[model samples]
Target: MLSFNIYLYCGGNISMKMAFRPTDGWRWYFDREYDSLMLEVSSDMLFRSCYPSKMLIPDVFSEFSFSVSDAASYYQFHNCCHSLNLTESQKIQLSINGIVAANFLKPQMPKSWYFSQQSTEYTPKVADIVKVYMQEDGLEVCMMVVEVGEHASLCIIAQPTFFSMNKTFYFSEAIKVMNDRLALAQQFAQPDNSIVLDDEELELKAIS
Candidate 1:
């Protein structure tokens, strides 16, 4: 079945005022195209009805390949199977948009396990899945989640790294140093703005 979206353009970012909650900082939204919930900051998505969707989750483990294509078909599968729990607004939105859910599943937000809730209880098999999923998720979704210090699932706290993570440094000092380095890089990047100095002159200036 063919399905499409018709978007009416809204000018100049005018929007309805809504209550601002502390947890709303991520700006999470539903992506109809993928039949998945998406992170606004990074566009990382999780398949809701189907766990480990062939498109969203890679076929990295094996060569078998099968992927869900569009919103209509995805919705049909979700509806016929009754896999998803939809609210009143979600039902209405789905009726209108053909696929998009009204909002995120509150319990299954970024902090919670997206795919398997039952697998949360510790087992050797679950532990292996966690390690594998983190690698399979790759730089796009998994890296962003890890850098922010959030554990998406009980299974995967985070991946081990080679370097020791230092947290003792002051945030403000780090920002200041980063800004100074950025300005220095920009200075050298532009030939007109770049400062040229001889080796002896540079050494003398460094000594001074």
Candidate 2:
């Protein structure tokens, strides 16, 4: 199978938006270019269908790769089909981009797994994937692949590490943070209402 990576583009200070419900945050949207698949994120995430003007290919994965900035000093390099088989809910979490997904399939995943409903046949490897996050003790946060989907599909394994009981205000909070950090590039003759791109070129919309 052939795998390609495409970045979503938008202008101005780029920020990520997440779609959310009051109870649970994160909405998933499917982008046909990357795959007919959408990962999960908070509601308030922002970005338009076209914003990023540049796409950079990194050296970590044989597949396509792109770098995106985050609220803090963290950076995320997204790779596609890095692995062949990943179970449902086994999402690759990008703290920088504020997105999580399991682009592959694994038999060990549960049937009630939420991500399995729309799961594809692509699994990404951690070694090939490059993710940068802040560390006080230098403990590498093990990448977790869970069955958690838009709506808590199966029993969610709540841990103290990443999962939080507090409603993190998925997209809104992230967008606010991103906008404050990035500088808007000079505006062209384009319209004012156009959405901006995130660290990756994907449209900033996180409305599932």
Candidate 3:
């Protein structure tokens, strides 16, 4: 059961108000709030960003929520089940409600590629944003490892789409939030429809 609702992440408590103003005509955005990542769109369901991909990281990307991989790392994630031995953290999918920094989860793959302790494949391109996977664990089931107020090296995590935090909140603080949001997102997702916010789709290649 894969859960994907990020709004539900922080305890399924944080509520999002619908301030969307889809107006008539207004074929293009008149302006945007750079500081808050607020956007204005037109009649199109597909709104393209004027900002380059390089300019979006940690800010706009955090708001929109996306990660991608090149050929090498793509293979690495797919082959991880066979080739590499990962630390405990790398083995699970995390819903972060905190901060992040340079080399977020460094010495590991880039933040764009999420590593699942289970055999989850990395998508092949940055254009594929909506990925569907099943969450093996129900949103209600999660094992807690760290305690609240305890400080550990911040692990790099990518929230689907909302905001990218600077790596501040504690692990214990995030547990209930992530689980609840996962259930709500139902794709982080729920057992039948896990929703991973990746930029690419899985293209499996026969390993050598």
Better of 1 and 3 by lDDT: 3
> Model 1 over residues 1-208: C-alpha lDDT tens digits?
1111111222233121322111223332344554543322212211122112222332122222122223333344234222223222222222222222211112233422212232233322111112212122221111101011123321111111111122111100000011111100101111121122222321111101
TM per candidate comes to 0.16, 0.21, 0.20
In model 1, what are the clashing residue pairs, if there are any? none
Highest TM-score against the true fold, candidate: 2
lDDT of candidates 1 onward, in order: 0.21, 0.23, 0.22
Per-residue lDDT, model 2, residue 104, is: 23
Q: What is the per-residue lDDT of model 2 for residues 1-208, given as tens digits with 9 covering 90 to 100? A: 2111122333443332332221223233434445323323323332221111121112211322222311111222223212312211111223222222222222122322111122122232221221111122222112222223332211111111231222221210111111111111121121232222233322232223
**Where is model 3 more than 4 Å wrong at Cα?**
1-24, 27-38, 41-109, 112-117, 120-208
Look at candidate 1 and tell me the lDDT of residue 34: 46
The residue-level lDDT of candidate 1 at 73 comes to 30
Over 1-208, each residue of candidate 3 has an lDDT whose tens digit, in order, gives 1222111021122112333222433232212332222222222222222222332244334433223322232233223222112222222112111211111211222221111223332322211112212233222222221111122122222222221132222111222111111211112321222233342211111111
Candidate 2, superposed: residue stretches over 4 Å from native: 1-9, 15-26, 39-141, 145-208
Error of 2 at 181 (Å): 40
